[model samples]
Structures are given as structure tokens and as C-alpha cells.
Target chain A: MNIFAPVGRAFFTLLAQIGRLTMFLVEVVSSCFRPPIYWYHIGQQMMRIGYFSLPVVGLTAFFTGGALALQIYLGGNRYGAEAIVPQIVVLGITRELGPVIAGLMVAGRVAAAIAAEIGTMRVTEQIDALTTLATNPIKYLVVPRLIAAVVTMPILVAIGDSIGVMGGYIVSTQSLGFSSGIYLKNTLDFMKNEDVISGLYKAAAFGFIIALMGCYNGFNSKGGAQGVGAATTNAVVTASILILAANYFLTSILFAK
Target chain B: MTTPKIELRGVKKRFGPKVVLDGIDLVINPGESLVVIGGSGTGKSVTIKCVLGILRPDEGKIFVDGEEVTHINGRARDKVLRKFGMLFQGAALFDSLTVWENVAFGLIQGRGMGRRQARDIAVEKLAKVGLGSEVINLSPSELSGGMQKRVGLARAIAADPDIIFFDEPTTGLDPIMADIINDLIVDTVKDVGATTLSITHDMASARKIADRIAMLYKGKIIWHGPVSEIDNSGNPYVDQFIHGRAEGPIKMEVRG
Candidate 1:
């Protein structure tokens, strides 16, 4: 009983955290439909969460695409199948690596940023000040970030998908002795619209997870500087983990056939 | 008799096992300033938070202008909040915004006023607090502590709210600046004709701004009276606190 007690407590704590996150999500989503959408704030957040994240997301995708092509070429050489590198690279980048890498990178960059900013506001009584000013903090802060993330993530993933395929193309043509026209033809012929759409859907879900985790941790942050730092760490960690987990589930459901 | 501007009846609040407010019953009349004075961690801030709906009381009833508002939510809560303004202890001005924008935030964001009109009103409010046009475009971080408090005061009064709250209005300023802030609070409250509730341990700030004083000790109101009567309130806790005496019925918890 004594040993089970710790397990029971930990289980309940996890349940409590899940419950809190769910409620926070419901509130933010509901606020989206209400009046006072704060179009200005949504635009600002889109610039921050989407535009500012482009360089990092693009660079990561490019590198991952190059590495994936290299790995597939080397692995396929043993089977005399190196000619399939372009096809494999395009399929993998568009379907998996592009959205996942972009999500992870943005989760590290944007989630930590959102958490630190909102957590500082929380500790310094700015959030309470918002309340007294007849403003809802969730509506004022969280909804805009959520909306911007949901809207811009698909765009980012789309761009990253193109850049990633370009990365594989460059590697295959310049280093692997494959002709540019043939590699391009293979990639174009192998890629499907459903693959791209599925990845975009995954990007949107990851964006929601990133913003939601950031805002939830930030809103619940307490103490002072240390509390905010902890919130930032927690936000990135939770978002990254959730993105991977959600990817697996989404992939299973979307590609069940 | 006129209905009290604000009233708390058996308002109790606790955090976990630690009770911060122990069944407080208080009233603030219309157009009067009431200051609650106590040492740190005496639940003075919590009392104000309860009234503001920033922190809900565990057990209580709170009323504003004779309307019960303890458990209201959503639009009703925002409707109630429209009548209030607050100056936080840290003078929590939004550091991201320019000084005038900080002052105009509640106006532009809460009431949806046009930006140009809100900026004009913000500048006027700043001038009322003795801030000139030169400081309008600067960020809150660029201002001195006293200037920040002035900007905070300007923001608090910008909406012309019916009730204003001052949380440690003179916490970090030098004696001269504290006095200046006190004078500003007095002038602004009078100008707006708003009932005010303030909490502080600064006796000078209390004496200068409060029409009436309440002494909170151990989460309860130990003594309350008009400012004229605070010095002679006769309760040992009140006597010890107001006079700044270390040795009396009050005991300081020196853990070290």
C-alpha cells in the first residue's frame, strides 16, 4: 500500500495536469468565436510565430532532406537500388521529416518564447492588471497566438516541404552523380497531393500543441524568475513530446488504409 | 443611510492549508478613501484581490454599489470590472508599450476607443500626473521608479472608474517621491470622485491619503477607525503598528 501510494499520487497529478490543459484549450478555442478577435494582435503573432520561425524551420528541413537522401542512397546501394534515392527522399520529406522537423524547431523557438513572455507578465501582475482593466487575459493573449499558429503552420510546412525536396534534389544532382532533370522528374512523379495535405494537417495540429503548451505553462507559472524559466523548459519539452506523439497517432489514422 | 460603495461580509480566503484572509467584514462608503495597513504577508493584498475578482474568496459575499458580485463570470464580471482601476505594488506598467500607450491601453483595448483619441486622453492624463509630453513615447523601463508610479497612476485614472485600488502605492520610492505619489493619489482620487481602497505598511502614505484606516493582523481586521482616531485606537496591535514599535502585543516572526 505504501509503495502504491506514490504511484497513485503521481497518476492523479498527471490526470490533473491533463484536465487543466484540456480546460485551457476549450477556453481559448471558445474565445476565438467571441467578439473582439484582436486582428492586430493576431497579425503580430503570425509575424512572430510564423515569419520569424521561417529561417530556422527552413534550415532544419534542408539539412534533414540532405541527410535523408544520403542515408537512403547508401542503404539502397547494397541492394543495387541507389536509383530510388530521389523517390524515397521526396516521399519521406513531404510526408514526415518536413512537418516533424519544422514542428520540433518551432516548438523549441516559439514555445520557449511564448512561455517566457507570458510567464513574466504573470509574475509581474500584468495579467491581473489586464483583468482589472475589464479584459480577459486568455482572449487578449492566448487566442491570438493560437489563431496565428493554426493559420501559419500549414504555410510554413508547405514551404519547408518544397525546400526539403529541393535540398534532396541539390544533394542528389551535385554530389550523388544523379542528373538534375531525372531527379526532379522522379520527385515530381512520386509525390502525391494527399501526402502533402496530410503533412499540412499534421503541421496545424503541431502548431496548436506548441501554442497551447506554451500558454498553459505560462499562465500557470508562479514564483519569480525561476518559475518563468521552469515554465519555458516545460513548454518546449511538453510541446516536442506532444508533437511526436500526435504525429504517430495522426499518421495511423490518416494512413490507416 | 446610503448604500456603501463596497462591502465585504464574512469574506474568507485561504491558500492550501494557510489561511490568508480570515472572515473579513469591511465597508467603504461612497467617495471616501479607506486604507488597510499591516506588515507584509498580512493578507492586505489578498483582500484587495478578492474584491477585484482576481482571486476569488473561499467563503464570502462581496458587493459593489449594493449589488452582490461574488461569483459572477464572463460578461457580467467584465461589466463589474469596468467600474474599477488599480495601481499595483510594482507599478506594473506594460513594459512593451510606450508610456502613452500604456496609459491608453484600457481605453483602446477594453473600451475600443480610436487610437488617436485614446492617445490624446492618455497624454492629458499623464499631464494631470505631472508627466510632460517628452516621456510619452518612451518605454516604461526607461522611466525612474517615481516616474513609473506616475505613469501607473495616470493609467489607473485614465478610464475615470468609479472605484480605484492602490496596492502599496508608495512601496519603493524615496521619502520625497513617496510623499509626491501620496499627494498625486489624493488629488487624482478627488478629481475622479472615485471611492478608493488602498493597502500599505507605509504610515506616512496612510496618514497622507486615508480618510479612514483599518489595521489587519493575522488575516483579520484588528482595528479600524477614521484617520484622526488611528493614533488613539487603543488596541495594542494598532498602537504597536501605527507607532512602529517593535516591543508590544504584536510579535514579529524572526525565523532566522
Candidate 2:
């Protein structure tokens, strides 16, 4: 037997998981046509993954937008052009920081919670109980979170983008010596609708990643309390990394011009 | 008198070098209660997991209603699952849902009943488990352990399943509450006339609920007999386990 066989097998297993995730998307898409949706479960997940996420996303966006304005104004001031702060800050927040930061914030908050909650259920055999009750564990447990993530993410990003732009406007008009109307007009003039749309699309993808990582680690969790803690940690770490990586790929394509 | 609800033959499961179940054989006759008893980590839970298809065995055959069900998946596995109910070890009521909602989950999700109809059944089952309608709207976490177990029991029988699996049904209950739950199990199963395969190290529960008892040791069933014949099983392993002795043929592994 080859000495490197274990390493090769581990790589193959990762590939297999990715392949299965692809198949799972197909399954979820098909199920969208099926009637009798688990509305209650979906609503519950929305409260967990979406509504509770607002504070973290909002605070992060506000601070990030403020910091961006300060940094840009300081850098551009050397050339006697600190006036472009609003335009740059709005574009930076809407096109990049808003979605990416929101994604990372959600990864830290929601993903770890999902992993811990579901991992506890898995270790306690609640998932098995769902199966025994003739409820498909994936459809019942996973699909709700996925649907909530997909549906709520765009909304969160939209909110974050608006709030972040406002944050930049606050700093620009007050601390940076730009008129409110001029700052607003500059942001509108410089950025197109494509930036906002692109950000929302990335948010949706990040939501899927957050939910997927949470469910995967939770579902495959082993041992008990220690295992659940580990799964929660892994879910957050993996989700944050993937969100950053996916953000880079999305940005490249969206900003290719 | 009727066909067996579950049958296992030469069932074995192993993880790396550790074997959990080894060459097991069992039959659970329809409408009868069969309890598997053993010390901690003796594969009682593993046996139930194998039957539920949560954990697949390394080798064996499992039959439900005389049909081979070991290797099935997707729709086939679901079809098999519809015949069963389970009460988990820790009262696995979804913390997110209300007590009534958890009980009605299978009815609404699996059977596609309207919320009104499912909630109606949920209330009725909860009443049967001695939980009032006032408690129905409350989250499961709000309830006490015995009450959570009651809710779990209520959920298990909510679908009126043809078969039921209860894992450590009374692990954390007081003797009176344990007896109450045991009695409820007996009453509800009789009302539905469901086949049950329960696993518990609790002899009082086994004696109260099981028509027959099987003792597991070192991943195999070393002794099995009618509950009426348990004390006289003449098997040292069974004696060591059921009586909670630390000596005899079975040695308690020293934890690191």
C-alpha cells in the first residue's frame, strides 16, 4: 500500500463532501416545488439566523463605514482632495465591506449556534428521532435553516449597505467638512446599481455557506459535549474562511471590468 | 401470535478496533415489549441505532415485518421509518418549539396534516401524558425533567406508530415519576397495541415494561428470557449486570 494513501483519501473525502453539497442544492431546488412547506420551522430559523443577526451586522457596518471615511479622508487630504471621502466610503462599504463583514459577523453568531444546537441534537439522537418519526432529517432540520439563510441574507446586506453609507455620511458631513447634500450627491453619482446588486448576491452565497457549514459540522458531530464544542468552533472558523475566500472570487468576477 | 415487527440476525458493528455489537440476534414480536438490558457501553443503544438506521452495522441482516431493511435508503428508509416512534435518552424535545408543537411535528411534517388537526392530536396526547393544555403553549425548556420526559413520551406516541423505541425511558426520573412513565408506556402501547424495543439498565423499568428481557455483554446477547424468568436466568453475566455488582465474569473497565 502507498504511504501517502491516507492523505489522498482525506482529500478525496473533502471533494466528496463538496460534490454532495452540489447534489443537495439540486435536491433543495426540486423540493421548492413540493407543497406543504414546514412554515413553522422556517419561521423559527428566521428568528434565530436573521432577526437576531441584526445588531451584530448593524454595529459592525456602522463602525467599519466610519473607519473607512477617516482612513480615506486622511489619505486623500495630502493632495488637497479630502472631498471624495463620501463617494469612496459608500462604494467601499456597499461593494465590499458591508457584505463581507456582515457575512463574517453572521458566521460568528449564527453558524456556531446552529452547530452547537444541532450537534447536541445529533449526539442526543434527536435527529434519529426525526427520522424515526418519518420526517426527513435533512428536509426538516437542514432545509429550514438554508431557506432562512438564503431569504434573510439579501435583506441583511441591503440594510447593512444603507446603514454603512449613512455612517460614512455622518463622519463626512460632521468631522470631515463635507456638505450633507454634496456628500449624498457624490455617493449617488459615483456608484451604480450594480454594486448594490453584486453585494446582495454575495450575501446570499455567504448565507448558504454559513448554513451549510453549520449543518455539516453539526450533522457529522461525534462524541458528546466536547464534540459539540469542537463542532461549534470548527463551524465558525470554516464559515469565516469560506466567506472571505468566496468574497474574493465574487469580487473578481463582479469587478472584472 | 402475529408476525414479528423486527428481527435481527448475526448483527455486528465495529468502529476501528472497538466492536460495539457482535453477532447479535433478536426478535420483537408485534404488540409485545422487548427490553434490552446491559451495563453502560454494552451496545444496547447501538442495537437500537442499527434498527433505526442511524448507525449501520458492519455486518448483519435486519428485517422489519419480515422484509429486509438493512441497506435501504431515501424513500425506502423513510417508508420503514413511518412504522416507528422513539423517545430519546435525554427527552429530545426541540428546545425551539413549544411543547405541543414538538409533539405534533410528525403529524404536521410527515403526515401532512393541517396545524389545527395536528395541534388537536398534540393536546390529546399531552393530556394522556398528564400534561395540561396550559402547558401546551410553553417551551419544552420551561418544563421540569420528568415533564420533559412526559412531553417526549407524548411526541413518541403522537403519530400512533406501529412500533416504538424508548431509550433509557426513566434514566433521570424519581421512582414515582419513573413508574408513572412506565405505566403510561404500557397503557399507550396497549391502546395502540404497538411493538416496542426498549433499552435500559433500569431493572424496575424493564420489569415493569418488558414482556421479555435480553442482557448484553461484550457486544453480544449473553442471556435472554421471559421477564418472569429474569431472576432465575442462571447466567452470571446477567446477574452481575441486573444486580449492579462490580465483580463476577464482567469487569468494569477502569477509566483513564
Fnat per model, in the order given? Answer: 0.82, 0.80
B187-206 in candidate 2: lDDT tens per residue? 98898889999999999999
Tell me the whole-model lDDT of each prediction, alpha carbons only.
0.94, 0.90
Per-residue lDDT for A1-257 in model 1, tens only? 48999999999999998898888888888999998888989999999999999999999999889998899999999999999999899889888999999999999999999999999999999999999988899999999999899899999999999899888888888899999889988888988899999999999999999999999999999999999999999999999999999999999999999
Model 1 misplacement above 4 A: B253-256
> Worst 10-residue stretch by lDDT in candidate 2 chain B?
B247-256
TM-score of each: 0.98, 0.90
TM-score of 2: 0.90
Off by over 4 Å in 2: A1-36
Instruction: Quote the lDDT for A13 in model 1.
Output: 96
DockQ of each: 0.86, 0.68
Candidate 1: Cα lDDT at A17 = 89
